[model samples]
Target: MSDWRASREAVELARLGVSELLANVAKHTASRRCGLRLVRVGADVVVQVFDESKQLPVVRTPDWCSEDGRGLWLLREMADGFGYMPIPLVTDTSYRLGKVVWFSCWGALPEAGAA
Candidate 1:
């Protein structure tokens, strides 16, 4: 994980972003199951969450006293880039519409021979 970036803070922030994405899925989606994928794309570590819902997540400003609706906002601030893409559904009856929410953190690649 540290290979993607020398800063431990960046890795931690990416983890938090993924957690928030999953939490949003559990709180808002009709489907209880979700998928998570992490990979190094170019100079960024991309965290993606796949959920069986076509609805795109909205980033909204919450009141200072509010207890909810700040997850995406925090993700946007922490990640270098964040967005969602709709997955095309198959014609098969077993398939359902879904989307993938992703966040990427940019940084230098891990040093050679480092784990």
Candidate 2:
């Protein structure tokens, strides 16, 4: 495992992102259950949350009086890059989506996607 002490901020951001992602899952997914998959690519980490919602996540501008709708907003601020992909599963009542969130710090100097 890599030492996250040097990049605690990124880890913390990932934590926050994951929290909001999961919360969104609970609130939006057509199904009651959701699954999360995390993978490490070089010095970066990618987090993907799969749910039954046929709709994709939207990064919306939060209303001033709203207490929610700021999850992906915070995630974009914390991630190096974010991606959304539709899963190719054959189903009628359920669908799967792939959300990719990457951390800027997590690997060694030469492995962190630096030039």
Candidate 3:
């Protein structure tokens, strides 16, 4: 198995991003169940959250007075890139339409490729 891991900052950001996404799931969707994946590509780490809800996330302008709606906007500013896309979810019975929200950040160790 690969021992690769993201940098501390990257991991921290990923944690925050995941928390916000899961919170959205709990507040906006009927089901809170979802899938999470972390993948490393070169010097970057990608975090993906898959949910059965077909509704995509929107980046809203920050309203300091508001309690919500700042998660995506803040994430976009902190992450190298962030976006969402429709995806096919596999199940025992049939395919379901869902979405994968993802963000990428630079995190690999400088000696990642070194012996």
Candidate 4:
């Protein structure tokens, strides 16, 4: 993030979002293993978590009193954009259905004109 000149606030938000998304996978999915990817596209940074489960994440009304079920809601509220999509998990032996949940922090890179 520092290499890309992301603001402190953006870095913090990205960290929090990753934690929340991974936590959700551990709590809800049958498989504990997942894949994580981070990419920089122009001035934006996108983070994605790939899980074997085909189920898409749902953003529900967060229960302030509860410890669970608030991650996705908070992520959606904080990130510049967030989404999930069904993807093909192609392995050497088989093809499986999976999903990737992603969130983007816009302007994570400094503008070309900025010093």
Candidate 5:
């Protein structure tokens, strides 16, 4: 992720976004096993976090007086777009912890550059 800052040009913003994402996963889901997925798709850098939780994320006002909850909000503002993808909703009665908190940022590539 060295180029994270270089690529985003808004290094601090990108760093804050990534840091908050990790922290949220630890605090909200509290899952033991988790991982990050970074993908370079066209002109966007897609950041994905996978965890073992059934809770779906929503955009809500995190108490400003508190020390947290501004992560997703900030990320949303900084990113081109972001959202969660639930595991394949199958007909079976089996439930699974296969959801991801994902976001995309305009990379340093020309395609994403200001027109």
Candidate 6:
């Protein structure tokens, strides 16, 4: 993870984004389980959450006092990239189908001679 140039602040933001994604799965999806993956592509760290839900998440303009529907928005603001992909199930399973929602955080480069 450190090889990706992930700063302290970036790692924290990534954690928050993943937490929101999992919360959404627990609250919205019918599946009882989910998967999370963190990977580095170049200078960016990608956080992915997988769940058995064909319904894609939508970005909404919630009321100022509303407590819900802000997770994706927060992720969009914090992460450099955010998106989802539907996975087709080839075998019979309880989930049947699923989706993978992902967000990427661009890591900050270290200053020369700082370390």
| Candidate 2 lDDT, 1-115, residue by residue in tens | 2352335665666677678778887787667566677676666666677665557778877786897777787677657777665665546785545433233334422355354
Q: In model 1, what lDDT does residue 17 have?
A: 88
lDDT of 3 at 20: 89
lDDT of each: 0.80, 0.62, 0.82, 0.90, 0.68, 0.78
From the highest TM-score down, the ranking of the candidates is 4, 3, 1, 6, 5, 2
- For model 4, the stretches where C-alpha displacement exceeds 4 angstroms are 112-114
lDDT of 1 by residue, 1-115 (tens): 6644546877788778877998899899988788889877565577889888999998877676988888898888778889998996565567767999998878735644566
Rank the candidate models, highest lDDT first. Answer: 4, 3, 1, 6, 5, 2
Model 4: what TM-score?
0.92
Number of the predicted model whose lDDT against the real structure is largest: 4
lDDT of 3 by residue, 1-115 (tens): 0346557777788889999888888887777789989887767788899888888888878889997789989999999989999999898999988999998887444455655
Error of 1 at 22 (Å): 0.8
Off by over 4 Å in 5: 1-11, 88-95, 110-115
| After superposition, candidate 1 runs with Cα above 4 Å error | 2-6, 89-93, 111-115
Better of 2 and 4 by TM-score: 4
What TM-score should be assigned to candidate 1?
A: 0.83
lDDT of 5 by residue, 76-110 (tens): 87788789866532337765655788877665344
Which residue pairs collide, candidate 6?
none
Badly placed stretches (over 4 Å) of model 3 are 1-5
Q: Report how far off residue 58 is in candidate 1 (Å).
A: 0.7
Deviation in Å, model 1, residue 89 alpha carbon = 4.2
The CA lDDT at 100 in model 6 is 88
Provide the TM-score for each candidate, comma-separated: 0.83, 0.70, 0.88, 0.92, 0.72, 0.81
The local lDDT score (0 to 100) that residue 1 gets in candidate 1 is 68
Candidate 1: worst-modelled 10 consecutive residues by lDDT: 106-115
On a 0 to 100 scale, what is the lDDT of residue 2 in model 6? 60
Per-structure clash totals for the candidates: 0, 0, 0, 0, 0, 0
